[model samples]
Target: MKNLPLGMNTLAKLIKQNCVYVDKTQMAWQLICQPGAFFLSRPRRFGKSLFVDTLKEIFEGNKPLFKGLYIHDKWDWTQSYPVIKIDFSDGTLQTRESLDRRIYEILFDNATRLNVTLSKGRDIPGTFGELIRFSAEKYGTRAVVLVDEYDKPILDNIENRDTAKIMREGVKNLYSVLKGQDAYLQFIFMTGVTKFSKVSLFSGVNQLTDITIDAQFGTLCGYTHHDLQTHFSKHLDGIEQEEIKQWYNGYYWLGETTVYNPYDILLFINKRAQFRNYWFETGNPSFLIKLFQKNRYFLPDLESPVVTEEILDSFDIEKINPLTLLFQSGYLTVAHTFTRRRRMMFLLKVPNLEVRIALNDHFINGYTDLVNEKIGIQDNLYTCLENGDIDGMLKVIQRLFKSIPWRNFTNNDLADFEGYYASVIYAFFCSLDAEVIPEDIDNHGQVDMTVKLGDQIYVMEIKVVDGTNADKLNCNPALKQIQDKGYADKYRGIDGVTVHEVGLVFSKASRNLIVF
Candidate 1:
């Protein structure tokens, strides 16, 4: 078996080292068949950089690297175009000056490689336009431009809105030059994590085609099921295939095929097939979590969010939508789609078990004060649910809520809002790997929360009341509401599974569970 291409992004190195390569040259060929600007957006570590490098090797006419590849026979080896490359995956640039320096270094390196001298005393845009024109003039053919991680500079400083905006304009100024060099450029393809409106980042080059959601290229970067069964079959011997798919294979791009992140697959095999949060552990999303909490977003909404096409397509630094950020950052993915009022709508969900567990784990931390104790609580909760121990589960939940820091409610009205408690509970259930549904609908009305665990199911309702009346209940109002509304009736007859109706009440004065 060929060696796995762990952390390898360059196409030439992978081929030369005899690493397992899923053939993407067919997609590359299709992309270059026409000469125009193209843009693709994908979450980080999803093989965007590798695809960009593949395009570089192809455009440079390195036919020796294409041995046994699909594009080798189809592409013309006699003609090679000048290629200018820009990659921002190396280091973080915090300010405009640093970003400018990095841009110059990238342009200069490309000019040196292409043997084109940039005009001295020229600004970035002027120098870029000059390099494109000169490189095409010298090579006697139009040039191909490939940019990897095109939005990284702006994203690096996203915490500081002013700096982020400045970095945005700086990169925008550089990309603006591409518009005037249309006659000199043969093809332009840029890859990034997020998609900004053309007016925000690519107004000058507004003609660029965005293929991020194009069905034809959906499987271009990630590993498909066929790839796992074929290219890396040797490495997957004795491993539970369904388990692997459950952990890592659910990302879709409006295509028939769902794919596994190459990073996760490579790391999974390298670590001897131990199922872990391989991809999620690579980056910290503290900013995203903070943003979600700042917005007071209901954690259960992430179970399945319905969004319009406009919500997913437009991203700007000035107003960052938490949903868009989550989707673009790979924490959420498209699960289903439908037409509502003649408009295309998407049903977004956590792609797989890896994301569902790991993301909610983070949300648990963000929503509560018990950081170190979360794992213990989640473990106990899991056992309680699996064994159908409602009393044990209630004790664990009360313990979980009792640990919340008072500061979480001091400056905020969280104590008065039932959603605050419900969201926290929802996040805990999600972290336990329970099949949780928020606002679950029934024939009568909507259930506040529904959880399916092993052979047990729970239909729950939450209510907030003042501490003065906390002791006056003959029946837990939450449970009474569930029984009154017939929320559990829908799941009562399922074979081999027991349906449970649970009601929980919180006291505003104590800011904790009062009745369970």
Candidate 2:
């Protein structure tokens, strides 16, 4: 059995070290056949660097490394080209001046590799251009350029718009050099997490093609189901496949097949247990949290569809923009896209279950309202559900309404209470591994919450009372509303699943609940 390639990205090194390699040979072959200035955008740690390194070995005329591989006999070993690879992940540049120095250092390093000497006193961009031209001239071949994490600097300062803009400008100055040197470049490939159209490098050099949504290259960056089944079959066979699928296989791109984040999948298998979110642990998402806060967007809405183009693009970091930042950062992808009555629209949701839970925890910590507080209410709703005390549940709801922050709940602002209550209930039951669903009977309008506890099923109806009449509560029209909605109609045929219905009402005056 081959070991997992945890952080290895070099194809030759992985082969020599006897690490597991899921062959993306077909994709590689397709790329080589139609090579040009290409840009691919994918989430972080999805093997972009490995793909770039593979391209380097192939184009640098390393035929020996291709032995027993897909392109072994098809590729020509006699043709070798100079390669200039840039990895913008060293955290070397913090300011514009430092950025300029780093760019010069990168150029010097590449020039030395090609045995080309640079004279003193040359501008950074000018020296970089000279190095490419010199390498091509000396080697009698065009140089292949590969850039990884091309947007790292901008992402690092996303929280500070001013700093992010400055970094963008400095990086743009370095990338603009590529535009005029196309004649001396054989092929140029750049990979980054987000697509920033305002970057002068992309705008000035209109020759490069973005293959992010192209179906042919959709699986180019991440691992596909086929890759997992073929390469990691044994490791998966040892674990619960259903649990793995539920956690990692929800992301869909271009309406094509779902893919697993290669980094997360490998880490999960190596660790031999379902652990806390490893992907989120790689970097801080404080910028994203700030975006959510500024936008006044409900964090729970992340599980549902968040649709808007302005939120998806041209987001000003100075303000909170959940849709734009999430999409740009790769946490949410284009689930579906179309023009609705002349405007382009997209459906945005959490990419996978791992991300969903990580995001939930992130919001839970950031928002004080999400946590439970001991105040004017005496009963605990979570404890009632755990102990199967249905009456206790009703009393708890009554106390909750009494403690309602009227200022926060007025002016129809509490419209999201249904969703909020549902989320809290769901979280509570999920903590106990109980199957729970909110608004499960949408057609009947009968049930507010449904929980499968042991062998019994509980059906609940919740209503907000506007008047103060404990005796007239059952006589109220809301009592009949649940029966009219037929919330329990679907459970008629399931044997051994006893269903119990409970109605609980709340008062808007005293903000207290009455249960029968």
Candidate 3:
């Protein structure tokens, strides 16, 4: 296999080093050939930086890089524009002062590159405006502005509203110059992980056409299936094609075909075709877990979050929604879209196994009990489920609840509701990477959960008592529901499968488990 572009983002270096270049020049050509400014939002490590660099190279008249590429003759190499590249992901920007200094330095560097002397009396916004005009005048060509990770400064301080707001204003001031200096700008493109609509950066430069959800540019940053087979065919020796596709592919943007996480694919091939959680290991995403916990989001509801276009686009930080955060942050993706009463609806789901499995671990850590007790509970839980020890599994659940801090249960009557117990049990099953149909509705009614083991299928019925009244809370009723309702009937005659019915009841006051 050719030298994989490992941790490579610069377009010039990637080309000069003779790395396998997936020709995305066609998409680059389409973007620049059009008019006005544009913004693209993709997940981190999705080649946003490389795409920005590619645009910079195209405008800088790097014709040799596109020699055998798709847009070799299609691009106009005679006219090269001075490019002003701004990257906010270089250093951490916690305070507004740091943000201001960083912008000043970036403008200074750009001026030095264009061989243009900037005035000492101007602020950042004024300096940026001067750079655009001066660079255009010096090079005799309109300057092309390319910004990578434009929202990093704001995103870094997102948890703190005060700090984030300060950083937001600083970045906004810098971007505001773009609107008035349009005459000196050829084309402007900005890429970031998040789109902050409330920030003045977007409001000031309102002409920026957001192509984030636009289906036309879905394959702009990431590799398509065709891209893999055509470009990286040499590295596909022992890899199972379908398995690879299942693990790394299926990131949809409402396009005809799905987009694969190029980072995962590259690492998978580089590591001798090993299937691993390459993308998930890079970022833990504690923010998402915190958001879900704060919002009291139903874990099972994440399976298929139905949302509208407005929900997908406008992500207001003040009133943050789990679905919006999940979708934008790459945990969830547009699985399918349909029209209902003339309004479009989108169904979002976890992209692949790497995300589903990894997110489960993170969710368990944040949602349920974590660490010390979690390790033992989960270990026994998995072992018991595999061995078809329903009693052992129940003990694990009892242990899980007991391990939680007393303060957690002070106000929250978690044991009072069947949904609460079912959700916790569901989370545990999912965390162990088991197949569980949570809230499985059968002919007998709604079963709490149905878990599939090697040769055993377990149908679980969970009941909760309001008080210590055994007369009102009978385990026989719960047991009858599982059998009379025929919850496990479907799996009874399946080949090489054994069906087991588990009826469980828990008391709200005592928090004791009773299995029938």
Candidate 4:
């Protein structure tokens, strides 16, 4: 196996140094066939820059890299076009002036590559235009423009709307220069993480074809399963294929297309060990946590589909929206898309188990309930499971519920609060290595939670009621709902299994847990 391209983004260097290449050659071939301007949005470090650099090499007519690749026989390598590669990932741009200075510098650097020096102290837009004209005049061919991480400046300050808007305006001004200069440009391709509305970045450049959701180029930025199996066969010879898939291979782009995280996969193969959160550790997303807190999101729903384009696309950041943040940050991806009554929608969920565990820890920290808890609670729960103590488990759960901060619970309605509490308890037991099944009791018609402990199973049904109405829940009619629904029916046949039906109610006025 070749050395991993951990921090390397330049395609020429990667090819020259003989690092492991996942062969996106077919994608390159298809991209070249498409006409006009293009834009692609993918998560960070998913080979976006590398794809841009590959285009830079291809347009510059670097024939050597294509000798054994897919475009070897098809592309006409004789025509070389001047390529302007603008990468905005150098440093975080906080101010408008700083961004302008950085843009000027990048344009000047590209000018020097073409052997054309700016006279002196020229404005960024003017310098950029001059570079295009210079390339066309000198090379006698139109220029190929590739802009990478085009939204980095705005993304750096996404939490601060004002700052992000300022940076967005600056980028819009700079990009607007390319609109009318079609004569000097042969093709333009820009890559970023998020697809802001055209009014946000492109402004009037609506000619930019967004290929982010295009099926043809969906596999352009990441390694497909076939690419990994065929190209990196040596690296997979001794490793557990299932483990690798669990950790890095869950992102779905086009329908039925499964892709791997090139960054984590490469790093793991090079280091030869199963490490946790390799890509996430590259940068801490503190802002996402703040979003979660502001929105008061229920964390346990990470496993279920949180589908809504409006929430996913334009969710307000002032309030912490965990689902949107997770989707935008690549921890979760678009599982599938469907059209209903002329409306298109996407279904989002946790990509895989790796993300599931990582997100669980993230939520645990977001809420204060996980920390400063009695160690005895976990110990008692584990012991109950070991001894098949159904009654002991229920007691442990009731005790745990009583420890919650009452003031916070009173704000939400009783029934909703009960559901939230039950979900959290389900997650807690799950984290402790206990087998807890959710929505499994058919007897009560609505079973909140169920736990399987060796030969013993505890079937639980939870309900929340106000302090004044709490007595109504203890009546036999309410308890009979659990039996009629057959919530405990499925577990009856298991050997040595004990099923305990439990009903929990909470007071909306006082935020107190009432166990029956």
Candidate 5:
């Protein structure tokens, strides 16, 4: 078996080093078959850079690297095109000045590599246009431009709206030159994590086809199950294939099949087949956590988020939708699709176990501020469910709610809403890797939350009372509703399953459980 290509992105280098390579040349050939600009959006570390490098090699006429590849015979190796590559996957760029400097530096490095002297005293756009025209002219063929991580500058400053917008405009200025250089460019491909709206970032280059979700190219960047079983079967011998699939395989793009993140699979095999959040831990999602709290987003909504096509693409620095952010960042994947009122809609879900656990853990931290206490809380909660101790479970939950800093409630009236409280509990249970079902359906009605652990099941109903009614504990509204709706009836007759119905009522004034 060939060695794993961990942290290796260059196709020539990977091939030379005898690394296991999932042949993507057929998809690459499809992309460059026509002379047009294209764009691909994938999460970071999804092998976009390596794919870009593969395209670079093909365009550079490196035929020796094409041995035994899918496009080996189909592509005309005699024809080589001038390739201009730009990668923005490096360190963060904070200010507009820094962004401009980085663009200049990238342009200079490209010019130096191609031995094309740039026009003196020209700005970023001018220099970029000059480079494309000169390179194409010198090589006697139009240039093929490839950009990797095209939106990193903007994403780096995503937490700061003003700076993010500034970075957006700066990159837009550099990309705007592409439309004018059409005559000098044979093909163009840009890859990034987020797909900024055409009007915002790619207004000048509206001709670029966004194949992010196009079915024809869905498996263009990630590894298919076939790729795994055919290539890495030896390395993963004796491992439970079903377990691996549950942990790291479920990313989809409306294709015939789903894909696994190459980074996750590679690391999982390299680390002795241990299942860890290898991909999720590489980058911090502090901004995303803050967005969730600031928006008071119901955590359960992510269980199966149904959004219109417009919502999926409605992303901008000024108006950042958390769902869009999550979807584009690989935290969510489309599970189903349908049409209503002539509008396309998508039903999305967390892709796999790794994302579900890690993402909820982050949200739990944001909601409860129980960084150090979370492990103890999860342990106690797990033990309570294992022992069927309802009172113990209630105390553990109450402790979590009390741990939230007062500032989390001061900015908004979130405490008055049942969703706020339900969301917190949902995050906690989900982070425990339990079978947590929010808005779980039954014959009679929908339950607020249901958690199944081993042979025990917990059905919970949450309610929030007004401040004036806090002192009056005369009503058991939450528990009464659960009983009246027969929310636990669905699982009561299961052979080995034990059902426990619990009601939690919170006060608007105190924001803690008043009745449990």
Candidate 6:
């Protein structure tokens, strides 16, 4: 078998080096066959760079590299076009000055590659406009412009609105030049993780078509199930098909099929098919965690977040909805959609077990403690539940709640609600990568939560004591409620499974936990 294409984004090199290729050239063919500017937004590390490089190779008329590819026979290999490519992933752009420098460097590199003279100007917008017209004039054909990570500068300074705004304006000026150079351009393709509204950056380039949610190109960058089974059968010798799908497959973009992150799959296959947090570990989740920490967005809402097109498209330097950032960043994906009041709305969710596990781990840290995630919380909870030490588990949960600074409860409007407590606990259980069902149902009515381990089931009922219930703080009403409601009945018939009943309570007056 050929070596896996882990971290290999150069299409020509990947193909020539005998790396496993999944034949996205067919999709590539479709993209270029159309006439118009196109934009694609995919999560970081989802092969956007590879796709951009593939386009570069194809337009450069590198026929030898395309011998067996779908576009080899279909494309006019004899017609070589001038390609001006700009990649924004190369440097730090924390300020307008830095952004100016980065844009100039990228433009200079492109101009040199195309052998075109650029008009000497201090302004990037003018230099870029001149480069396009000059390149087309010299090549006797329109130029193709490919921009990879076009939003990096803005994303890099997202937490700092003032810095990000300055950078956005600078970058906006550079892209605005593209619309004026339309006469000199053959095709324009821009890719990024965030799909900021056209008004923010691309209002001048009005012809740019956002294919981010287009069904036809949904599988363009990620690996599909068919791709895995057909091209990676050798690697699937011992790995369970269902397990693989559950771990990484389920990123949807408004189509029937779901695609898996290529980064996760390549690493999984290379590491002897061992399941792990491959993609999540490649980047830090701290920025995302901080977003939730500040907003106090309920963790459970991540499972079924509902938003309109406006919400998904609203990403500016000064304002950002947590859902938009999470969806655009690959931490969440389209679960499904509905037409409500004649308007399309999408329900977003964590894509798979990998995202759920990784996100909830941070959820525990950012939501509960904020001070320490290194407390070995995951391991301690795992140990407690595995040994059926309910008391230990309760104590650990109490500690998790106590780890929060006093200010969190007093300062945050949303943190004191019982829903907040339930959401954090749900996040804790889900972070274990276990089967945790929130708001589970039983014959009697509803259970607060249910979890299944190796051969054990846990049924829990939780409550909060308002000051009116201060006299009942020491009472085990939670246990009485669970027994009275028969919340454990759902697991009664399991032949070998043992059911553990847990009743948990938090007292507002005492600011503590009680367990029975």
The number of the candidate with the highest TM-score is 1
Tens digit of per-residue lDDT, candidate 4, span 256-312: 587888888787776776666777667566677656555555544554564666556
Q: Which portions of model 3 show Cα errors greater than 4 Å?
A: 198-201, 372-376, 407-420, 441-448, 466-472, 476-497, 510-516
Among these predicted structures, which one has the highest lDDT? 5
Q: TM-score of each candidate?
A: 0.98, 0.78, 0.91, 0.83, 0.97, 0.89
Model 4, residue 148: distance off in Å is 1.5
Please provide, for model 5 over 332-450, each residue's C-alpha lDDT reduced to its tens digit, 9 standing for 90 to 100: 98898889889888999999999999998898888778889999999999899888999999998888888888987776888888998999898888888888889989888898999
Across residues 5-108, which tens digit of lDDT does each residue of candidate 3 receive?
99999988888888888888887888889667999989989999998988888889889888898889998799999999999878788987788888888999
After the best TM-score superposition of candidate 5, give how far the Cα of residue 55 lies from its true spot, in angstroms: 0.4
Q: Candidate 3: how large is its RMSD?
A: 2.7
Query: What are the lDDT figures for the candidates, one per model?
Result: 0.90, 0.69, 0.81, 0.72, 0.90, 0.83
Candidate 2: worst-modelled 10 consecutive residues by lDDT: 370-379
For candidate 1, the lDDT comes to 0.90
The clash numbers for all candidates, in the given order, read: 1, 4, 1, 11, 0, 0
**TM-score ranking of the models:** 1, 5, 3, 6, 4, 2
Candidate 6 residue 427 Cα shift, in angstroms, is 1.5
Residue 63 error, candidate 5, Å: 0.3
Task: Give residue 122's error in model 2 in angstroms.
Answer: 3.0
Writing each residue's lDDT as its tens digit, candidate 2 over 234-348 gives: 8877677677776776555563677878888889888885754777678577767655544445443444464756555453434535666676666787777778778877787
What TM-score should be assigned to candidate 2? 0.78
Residue runs of model 6 more than 4 Å from their true location after superposition: 370-380, 383-392, 403-415, 439-448, 452-461, 466-503
Give stretches of model 5 more than 4 Å off.
442-444, 467-471
lDDT (10s digit) by residue, model 1, range 1-516: 999999999998998899998989999999998898899989999999889999999888899998888998999988899999999999999988999999999999999999999888889999999989999999999999999999999988888889999999999989999988899999999999999887799898848998887789988889999999999998998899999999999998787899999999999999999899999999798889888777888788888899997788788888899999888888888887899999989899899999988888888888886789998998999999999999999999889888888887767777788888888898888877889989999889998999999999999999998874666977798988888899999898889999888899998888788898
